[model samples]
Target: MAKPIARKTSRGADRMETTLNNKVLTEIWGADQGVGLRVKQAALVVLGIAILAVAAKIKVPMWPVPITMGTFAVLSIGAAYGARLGLVTILGYMIVGAIGFDVFAGSSAEKFGLTYMMGGTGGYLVGYVLATFALGLLARRGWDRSFVWMALAMLIGNVLIYVPGLIWLGQLYGWDQPILQWGLTPFLIGDALKLVLAAVILPAVWSFVGKART
Candidate 1:
């Protein structure tokens, strides 16, 4: 009886020691953690942004604007990073492009012009930031796994990006109807495909990554 009690005491003490150690370590690293995490996050966002531009280069020209894989990166990054970080990353990319960097689609280093980069799909670019917020909202609510929910997530993302994009495109063409003609009509099918693909892949990627983390 004494032996069992002693053993139980030993186990309890060990568990307590472990918990204390964990708490201490967490406290020690907590401040650095926020900074480190932000740095790491920014790096990932930059990579995602670069990938967006690279994807555009792989475009298969179709209509008003060429269909590019950039949209995939846009939608995927949001679902992957959640709302806040996703928005930050895409917004960071836009800021970089806006500040006269050739980081946007078709803005070759040789040409290196900001006009095309900021003018053509600028609305969509801004919209991408909004999409990230929308996508992140649904994903955090545990809708990341459902196809219907994920599809809705992507659809909302597209709408967020496209609507403002259409308005801007309309402005550019100096015609109110340019949105219907240039923005929405031209990219409907392609955007739908991109949304479907994002919806399919985001949950799987997150799930796989989650399993690894666990």
Candidate 2:
């Protein structure tokens, strides 16, 4: 009986290690072989939803405009959770916002829920999912392990976000309207700052984890 139990434990650890081969940052802490993937994902999704809400609501004062952490949170979560889990987490957060949770940066009690979702920010919301997916894919390819690759990945993700976002703005408003000014230009500086921050943070974390292991 003892030998069988030992073998089972070793097998489980082996399975977990195999699964974690292309691990994201979140798996670096609190992951256990005895725990199932579904359980870990469910918990991470919940925590991610909460983090999205808080990041959406908070604003840091900056020179051009107040910096909202919403996009940063979305990208980071995608990089940390990978593609499928990131999709689920972002979708869950969107659903919560759609149901009138005040989970969006521009939403208010007076104008919240699905109506708000269908407004100007609608395209950007769609972009969030696309960008998240792209980031997840890049992170899986080890882009998040180095500052240069991470920065490039972030630039690609931002482009994914802005493309649909600008198109949506054009369709919603008018083609002649200053869609660039309204939706893209003002945000570029802030996005650049965020890109640098993410580039520095993700690689530094990987370095820390590597050192700690040795």
Candidate 3:
């Protein structure tokens, strides 16, 4: 009787491990099961927020909106964390910024807290959340495995960010404000570079992971 129970327990453990391995790559790579998983996930959220803060600070000044690596970080985190955790992580970052942390692109005494969130770049920030969600969904679908598919996924995420951003800019400055020049054109080249880099990096990482697993 004791031996049968032990064999059953072992089988259950094996099943749990199999389930974890079959999940999205990020979850498989970063998470674990049982009692410690929640704590591990919380730590991942904090780390994601920290990464966003650092990326926000690496910017090139431009009119209306400064070009920043924040977008790149957002998409990358999504692709690496899956939908639920990715959304949680991004929302955590936003909440931190909203509560007056100096985590935004150009934090200053004059521009912090909710006031900054409601500024010209506010839409872009919201877009980051949406884009991250989208990318996370794609990542769960295993879109990150191929370079072409990953590129398309990243491109979609990039476009998602601009949509809300442009709309908000239009509303703030009105139709005659040349919103495109200020909000979109300046960042085209930079965004393209980021997109390509992300596309390349994700597929390469997936390849490396495959190699390591084998």
Q: Which ten-residue region of model 2 has the weakest summed lDDT? A: 29-38
Reference-based TM-score of each model = 0.72, 0.87, 0.85
Residue-by-residue lDDT tens digits, candidate 1, 45-112: 77877876677667876656678777777777777666777777787777777677776666765655
**Cα RMSD to the true fold for all candidates:** 7.3, 5.9, 6.0
lDDT computed for candidate 3: 0.85
lDDT scores of the candidates, listed in order: 0.69, 0.88, 0.85
* Residue pairs clashing, model 3: none
The most accurate candidate by lDDT is 2
Which 10 consecutive positions of candidate 3 have the poorest summed lDDT? 17-26
**Which scores higher on lDDT, 1 or 3?**
3
Model 1: lDDT to the true structure: 0.69
Estimate, for each residue in 106-151, the C-alpha lDDT of model 3 and write its tens digit.
Answer: 6778899899989888889989999999998898777877788888
Identify the candidate with maximal TM-score. Answer: 2
Could you give candidate 2's per-residue lDDT for residues 1-214 as a string of tens digits?
Answer: 9999999988977776566458888777774456575688789999999999999998988767887989899998899888888999999999999999999999998988999899999999999999998898888878998999999998988898899889999999999999999998888888899999999999898888765653
Report the number of clashing residue pairs per model.
0, 0, 0
